[model samples]
Target: MSIIAVVGDCTTTTALALAAGWPSGHDAVILEADRTGGSLAAWLGTPASPSLSTIVANSPALGNSPSTAWSAVDAMVRHAPSGTRFIAAPVRSRAASRALSEAGGTLFPLLAQLYEPTIIADIGSYAVADAPSVLFSLASSIVVCHRQDAASAGAATVRLERLAELVQFLATFGVPLTVALIGDRPFGPDEVGQFLTADGQAEIVMHSLPVDDLTAAVFAGRTGVSERRLARLPLIREASALARQVAPAETDRAPDSSRIDQLGSSR
Candidate 1:
């Protein structure tokens, strides 16, 4: 049940995942399914598993005729660790999460059942009406990946509505969401506050992942999990705690928001 969905732009999520100690050589994991292949794949240097194109090519495995060609999809997930796996909807931005219907909500949790402690899903940057909602429907916590600019956060804020509706609709699945913001540069909470206006508000929750030198080290294939864990200071620790709180539980209820210290870093 220690599963989290890292949503939004993949441009910086690889760094965010490493900062959070995913696949951290512990009871943690980071699973990626990006068709162009995300920064995580390059960071981890793992091999190519099946992709959206792979599933698209094999659509008949899930449903009707082969000639129908990608009208339907079979979400392709691959076991990356004993208790962690990677799944990405290989279609273009809008089509990314479409595999939810093909795999059902069971796809993520099924891997979680096998992978156990933690699962980080890298959902690339596309918050369309269809697939992102489906992925959010499956997430225990969603790391809303944004850049450190005013615009990306602005986009993230607007996208929060779709997230709210999806969470409400997925009641039968059971799991509230915690939202974490990931950016490439450093920005204080006050600066972030400016963009997070009421129009951008969504009820699930939010957190920040700090950008740092060691962060770059980890993603550059320089450090291992044991080497980098707890190195980003408070931001890293808070992220791990939030991941735990959201991952293990499945219900409309989320961990108490007030008690959770929203963590970040000093410039």
Candidate 2:
């Protein structure tokens, strides 16, 4: 089973959407731990309520019914259009941060039980060692999304530095981290990756999500056009290739692998 943990900003939700749409019925879930903008809900079609919040608040009493929990999960799943399943975090990422701080590596395996062999987490800036958001230790693969310019590049560099500092922290917990760099279309994979690494970056196992029409599909909530185009694009292909690196078999892959659009490199 591959547990993909994403650590980045709110745009991470869009990344998850892309991951979901990579193929039809990608058996994946999103933990909308980013509580600031309700970005996950925005991506999930308009939600009826903060039911994820309610569930986290009431889980102890409700026996944490997977059926009921799954109800909320289902609502968001509808917005997905792709075959991905998701659950926003208990509250904001900060709250989940607390849970992570207290629990160590507990939430992922339990959540893993409810899904398929592959799991993708839209983790935020919480990859740090002990301040507490989420742990990189739980990830089979850790993808960090960032831009290429100095500001974003600088941030990515810091994150890479932090990820290194905390390697042992996660290794102790059984997490294997492989870092990737994501950028928009204006930036080429080689260009962004090279600039970032020019200064001797963290041996970044890096690649990028080049800007293209697919992002428009995500925003308009009708990505079929972009999805079709991207099904052949290098960004998606590289993502698939990386995904397969960690998880090879079809069952090991997200549902997107089954799609006709998947590029050879992706598989």
Candidate 3:
């Protein structure tokens, strides 16, 4: 039950689209937690009925208990054509935006606790505000998606600095932070990661998603490509790789007998 927060310096919709294609073995949900708004409803051509706005507006009646709050969030979830479930952002009214500001910190912390499904949240860009920064404390993994070219790379560095600042306060939890490069370039993931890692700018896991316009269109609901065909695309393959890298199985790790014995003794 890990919460993987996908955020960026620029638009993260494409990154979210790629993430939505991850090979989900468990129940997975994409949450549009961007305080500004979410475009998933429009992209998937689904009505914004059960959205974040709906949950926030109903929060008052739902009571302050974690169960009630989670119930409200659960009810708002809608499944996409791609088999990805999501809670959309507000589109019609600005009230939902306000709701996110007022209660986002509290509500999302509860969702992060649900262990059944892996919550891949499209948190948009990082912000200094509590609404967006709260996830830095709760998320098991934080992927800062950014463009890889020269210009955007500079901006990405700035964004990473901001993210580092936020994570510093929560470092004791050992949250895994990653920088996911989106777009094509001569630089490989390791090369870019090395440059960023130099000078201890910030240590981060590096991942890449090649620019595949066709696959992007399919994820954006712009094409009529079948799911099987879409699955074969380079975009999907890279996303799958990134997903596996970000969340590998516990069995893939070597056993730490000493740590196990220590835990046993403590118990």
Winner by TM-score: 3
Ten contiguous residues with the weakest lDDT in model 3: 255-264
RMSD of 3: 9.6
Clash statistics: count for each candidate: 4, 9, 0
lDDT of 1 at 24: 29
Ranking by lDDT: 3, 2, 1
Residue 41 miss distance in model 3 (angstroms): 0.4
Model 3: per-residue Cα lDDT over 1-267, one tens digit each: 567777764334544443444444445577776766778887766887778777767767655665666676777788665455778877633654675665555677666665646677777765445543566667887777766555566675665556556444334446777777776454567766676666563557877767777765655666556555655667566676666666535312222223212212222
Output the number of the lDDT-best candidate. Answer: 3
TM-score of each: 0.52, 0.61, 0.76
Q: In angstroms, how far off is 239's CA in candidate 2? A: 2.5
After TM-score superposition, the amount by which residue 30's alpha carbon in candidate 1 deviates from its true location, in angstroms, is 2.7
- Model 2, position 10: C-alpha lDDT score: 33
Steric clash pairs (candidate 1): 33-88, 52-90, 83-115, 175-251
Q: Give the per-residue lDDT digits (tens) of candidate 2, residues 26-132.
A: 45555554434235555545463543554444444433443444444344343333434456554455665554443334334344435453556666654443354
> Which of the two candidates, 1 or 3, achieves a greater lDDT against the reference?
3
